[model samples]
Target chain A: MGAMSTESDPLSVHDQVVRSTYACIARFGMAKTTVEDVVRESGLSRATIYRHFPGGRDELLREAVAWQIGEFFIRLADHVEGSADLVELLDRGIEFARQAVREHALLQRMLVTEPDRLLGLLSTESTKTLPFIAAYLLPHLERARAAGDLRPGVDPVDASDHLSRLVLSYIGARGVVDLDDPAQRRDLVTRELLAGILRP
Target chain B: MTPEASPDVRARLLDATFVCLARVGIAKTSVDDIAREAGISRATLYRHFGGKAELLEALGQRELTRLDAVFAAAVQDCATVGAACSVLVVEGAEFLLDHPVLGTILAIEPTAITPLLSLGHADAFLTAAAALVAPHLAAHVDDDAARLRGAELLVRITLSHLQSPNPQRSITDPQVAQAIVDQYIVPGFVGKSAIERIQA
Candidate 1:
């Protein structure tokens, strides 16, 4: 996927833009990152970048969002499927997520360079970035419910929403949990959240 | 039109109004104090802003104008609808969270915002904030149910964030509050939508 996309794919242009954009994001974060930076980093002309991304910066971010979502699912699905128990699976998955949180270009940028901007992306009701969380987690949560593993009569949807919100609430509360301290905050949140939700 | 209605008199009175409001707050602030702050006769202060309600309304407008400018500046660099919406709330929220006087009023003395000036009241504030945010959530435009649900969640989350007792604290702290903005609020909204698609 990488070589083909970079070399000959029709989306080579698009891929280049994403690469350039994220590289800028990696270095400067969303606030300081710019179309010029993406172009400069990609060695693509401004015209080429605009050619690939019509909405420009926002479009690039949206694509970046989709790209991130794809990567998140790849890791999350692997984590989910590798284990049988939802609790254990989620525990592992949460660790993966925590690692993602610590290392994620977007999350890292938001946390370090532009917390105000990041919180906006995260807290806004309809932003694509935040909802991807629910979409990714919902299916498996429902599966847990169907298997009679979740608390009875608890709306699986509500429960899933609760889980994400719970994470967001805590994660959003900066200075509370050490985001980079993977073993500490990540494990505890998953454990405590699961403790209350597991069928008892 | 009249000597009693000079611009200098009006400006002096307005400044005094805020000075009194700042030192004592709306409830305890009195017209006499405003006059003192302005170095004017008590009768002169009333001449500019008639009663408490009128005085408060003017002050609130000034604050809203400042907030509006802040909102505009925050989004000046944003490119897409989602970025704009998300950034507005995230940045605005942080500002609301840390703003000393405003934060104190919101967290400790919310009565100041309750009837919220008829013009820039809570509903109006949400509506404008929602408008600012609605662009990013546009994907849900076709999904009214999801959009509305998301909007409701957004409103609740924003209010909860504003009302949060300690913004700088962590979840692990012993004195952590019972109400969690993300744990309960965000999931309740985002998760519900995700669960709905699954249950469907």
Candidate 2:
């Protein structure tokens, strides 16, 4: 079962391995996916994958998760666009998160088939994820702070962590809010969240 | 006498559900197993609970009741919105995270339980959690719906942290949890100056 590749460049093999791992998790779940599946999916030899991820399956899975999150944040930045208005930014962030959870292949598979595993990783590894997200948000938050959009005494690091946690909570609970309606999403994010940190 | 709708039966069934869940997890714990564990016939189990879903729902409610008691006690003496909410949020997170049944379900059966965390249930929980702090909030913030909104935010924040805690931060630690509440949560209920004054 060789992966169909349009490009044979050396760097693409790394990308191919990561993508294959993600697809295996999406199809088989964390508990059931094996290194052999990654090898088969990627059309790469087991030795090659082991060379790249010496820790084996777990390492590959970890890398895959990081890659997926990295890509997600990039898309998130585009949608949020560093809005000066915290409320508007939060509204957009919530919308993007809801859609991501619903549509992201990896996330949907994880949520449906191995939610506990996903939650376990999130709870334990979120320390890594939080800083990663906060760093991504640092620039946006700093820009907002400079524009005087944030309330006095708000730290961008703190704000990024707090906002990231807020978004993660909404995403995890799934039923905490009606993400279906755009107006309601704005109202909840603004009234419940932005009001606390954003300038009046 | 096997009274079909006895509280004793409900309690017995819930206890059995906990034992089975702890041992084999939600995916493996079946209605038949619960009934067998409770030493009741399948007919009796069905007589009490419509099915496995109904029984699990009841288990969730039972856990919420236990949590409500913890939250009620935690906020009993607090006078201000921030004071009551910080205590409630911090204590609630600890209680939920430490509770054997809920913690196990969250760790092992996350996918099946997402719907249980949905907005409707969360709103209901928030409304209940807020009612405890509403009187205190009323004495402080004159704005209508402030207490309800604050409760929702507090609960959401706590839920988020519990679900996906920062790797570097310990939500279970009182100092860390309190600081987060102080920085991100308190200001939502009280104005920024109130937090500033308290900090100063």
RMSD of 1: 16.7
TM-score of chain A of each: 0.63, 0.78
List runs of model 2 lying over 4 Å from the truth: A1-12, A21-41, A53-66, A81-92, A95-128, A142-153, A170-191, B1-7, B27-54, B106-148, B167-169, B172-178, B189-200
Scored by TM-score, the top model is 2
Give the alpha carbon lDDT tens digit for every residue of B6-107 in model 2: 679889999999898877778888999999999888998898899999998899788777776776677678775566666776777777777776667667
**Model 1 chain A worst lDDT run, 10 consecutive residues:** A168-177
lDDT digits (tens) for residues A1-200 of candidate 1: 13334434547778777866766776777777788888788777788788778798877865665676566657766766757665566556655665665566456546556554444333332223344556666887788887888754466665565455444433333222243565655444443355335553
Residues A133-178 of candidate 2: C-alpha lDDT, one tens digit per residue: 6676677778888888887778888788888766655654433347
